[model samples]
Target: MSGVTLSNVVKKYGETQVIHGVELTVDPGEFCVFVGPSGCGKSTLLRMIAGLEETSAGEIRIGTRDVTRLDPAQRGVAMVFQTYALYPHMSVAENMGFGLKMNGHPKAEIREKVAKASSILHLDDYLHRKPKALSGGQRQRVAIGRAIVRGPEVFLFDEPLSNLDAELRVEMRVEIARLHREIGATMIYVTHDQVEAMTLADKIVVLRGGRVEQVGAPLDLYREPDNLFVAGFIGSPAMNLLPAHPTEGGIHVPALGPEVIACRPPGHVSELVAGFRPQSLRIGAGDTHSVEMTEALGGVSFIHCARDGQPKLVIETKGNHVERPGTDISVHVDPDEMFLFDKLTGHRLR
Candidate 1:
């Protein structure tokens, strides 16, 4: 097992720079996930570490060895991509062992490695079948098994479950989690899905526009985002960011009536934004806001509401407490559970 490190990493395509100075370290045997919106450079950063993409500047280290200039094959890493990328004609056993075969390993050794990978991935039953005969999840497992046979120091997964169906994605998530526990290798996974990052990572690196927004444990980022972007992007349904202005005693919110909220930051400030999670909102009767939509997901429901001059807000509530669209409702905001950010700079206010 080996840890991965990037020091002041940068990437550029001609004069257009896609990745900013990035500093990160993945501890040995830790599962690290890179998550962001599309075009955020998460995939680019992953590729750079895998040696599939060149680094314009900075050093990448796999263990103690600097791999910044090494060839992809020379790096002690395995990559599982979004696509299965399996050869249709090859059986599972052949596909898993093909890398070893090409590397000039003995036939017996190749078979043993293939068998071990197959067992680890629960692919022993499908070894005789070709990729065409397998389901999407099964084929992905075969792709993973192929990586396993290489005995890589670090595993790189670039949205490996994006191709699977909803149910299959869930199953694959469990499978991958178990595989991580069983192997205990350093793994770096990149995905745009916050849910996946939340569930699968020992540390989550949140990125935005080629810059890393925050890096920490999932709940740490969720509960204590460094800025407004991290606050909004880390959670499902997102944190509700409402426009407001600082008052003498509290922050004044038009929608919440003449009564001021006593949640202003220390010192004098002008414009501010109030943030709170949807789950933190408690529904009540009022005429200030109106429900726009309701999404019931079996046990929980999300109430999408619209305030007169503010952005739309989603409130998470029990499924049994579903409110109809156009219903007049009010939400209570707890100052202790709320977050405050500077409206101008988008920086969080402590």
Candidate 2:
């Protein structure tokens, strides 16, 4: 019942509009992530939902209650920012219980809530340590613990993992996932990292230019992107987009030579863009295409190559490959894996 709903939400700053009529819904206990490149307004939308930012138009509802004009404290939501924002002068336990203490809760009650949150975050041993004494990951956990003590109906995370090191980011991703499962609170997270969005979200809202590009489950968006933008943006290393033209049999990709990458396209589209993921492409031994580079990341290697000096196409290869730079290779285009889009419009051609 604590799910969030937004109806044609809009935000403007002195006539400069940002969020434009965004309609979204997050089910209770669901983990929703807002993901996009920078300046896409993902963080602005999260702030609007948290009641920290005012809506220029439309309404926001949380658990059947309209909170469009309510104060942030009035909305049953807790937010954890990218920064820990913990008190360096106080112990971990003290920092966690500060909000409750301000709300005039009894000392015994505050201690109990802090203890429960600490146990959940595995901060029991470090409860007496100050913020300066903890690692980045531990400090982030303490920030999360502070939110947990409030028992908010919804949790807002604005790129909470961005501040951590690569290893710590991975570790915290697991921890956040576990926290969602354990607490089962409705959570909305915003991040620019597609990997984090794919791993943490039950549903992802992909935003662009202050508008929603697409919203769906991670694999759903991956397998069937609505446009060239979604296809190119959602995956790691990104999907390969090459200029092509529609022909009688299929789309002719100059990069792959005369043989067209087979795909059924709606009529009226002549020029098109052919899309393929790195994993979907296979390279054969040939000199027609030269290997530009190979990224060896254990067990799998991403082979980057170009056809006739065109845009580089990435092909994923499993196991050990002896292919070195300047090695000539040929691509085996899987017709079934091909995605076609309108060249000019960038819209997917069904």
Candidate 3:
């Protein structure tokens, strides 16, 4: 296993910079996920570390070797792309052992390595099958087995499960976690899916506009997002935001009329946009919502309500509840769960 370090890294295409001065460290045997929306440079960053893309200026080190300008094969990193990228004509075993054979490893050693990897990924039964003959998950496992037989120090996955259906996605996710545990190699996974990041990462690096936004454990980022972007980006139903004016050391919603324009000031007080997750706000006698619609998803339901004529609120609730259109309903919000963002900069107050 090996650690990866990027110091003051910058990636540019002509005059346009796709990656800013980025600095990050992936610990040996740690599972670090690079998660962000599309065009956020996550895969690009991974490619830079793999030496597939040359950094405009910076240094990349794998273990103790400074490999900023090294070719991909010499970087001790293996990347599994979204596409299976398997050799169509070759059998699973040949594909898995292709790297070893090309590198001139002994025939017996290649067989032993491929066998061990196939056993680990449960591909032993499909060794003779070609890519077209295997299921999606099985094909992906063969792809992973190819990476495994190389015995690389770092494993990089670029949205590896995007092609699979939901059920297979979950299965592959668990398989990756198990593989990480069994092999104990440094892994950097990139995906736009928050659920994947939340479930699979030991540490999550959230990115935006080609810059690092926040890095922390999954639950920590969920609970204490660094800014409005993160607060809205990290949750399932997303945080509810409302325009309000500061009043009497608290916040006021003039649109809700005089009586119900109530909520104490949040801890991170600033000339801010007040925010709270829809899940954290509750409908109560004193709290309020202007019911617009409802969306039910099995045991859980998404109650879409609004205040005045503003955008609807997406609230997740346990069980179905009947509601009429445009009916006024009260909702309670816990002050501690509220997040405050500077109106102009969108930066968090604390």
The alpha-carbon deviation from the true structure for residue 329 of candidate 1, after best TM-score superposition, in angstroms, is: 1.5
lDDT of each: 0.91, 0.92, 0.86
lDDT ranking, best first: 2, 1, 3
The residue pairs that clash in candidate 3, if any, are: 284-330, 287-330, 287-331, 288-329, 288-330, 288-331, 289-329
Candidate 3 residues 1-350, lDDT tens each? 88998899999999999999898988999999999999999999999998889889988999999999889998998999999999999999999999999989999999999999999999989999999999999999999999999999999999999999999999999999999999899999999999999999999999998899999999999888888888888978777766555677567644333543345655555466777787776677654578788777678777777766665677677787656667777766666666767777777766
Worst 10 residues of 1 by lDDT: 257-266
Better of 1 and 3 by lDDT: 1
TM-scores, each model vs. reference: 0.97, 0.98, 0.93
Q: What TM-score, to 2 decimals, does candidate 1 have? A: 0.97
Assess candidate 2 and give its lDDT: 0.92
Candidate 1 vs candidate 3, TM-score winner: 1
Report the C-alpha lDDT of model 1 over 11-65, residue by residue, as the tens digit: 9999999999999999999999999999999999999999999999999999999
Q: Give a tens-digit lDDT track for model 2, residues 230-305.
A: 9999999899999888787767888876676666655898888899899989877666688888888878889988
Clashes of 2: 1
Q: In model 3, which runs have C-alpha deviations exceeding 4 angstroms? A: 253-270, 286-288, 322-328
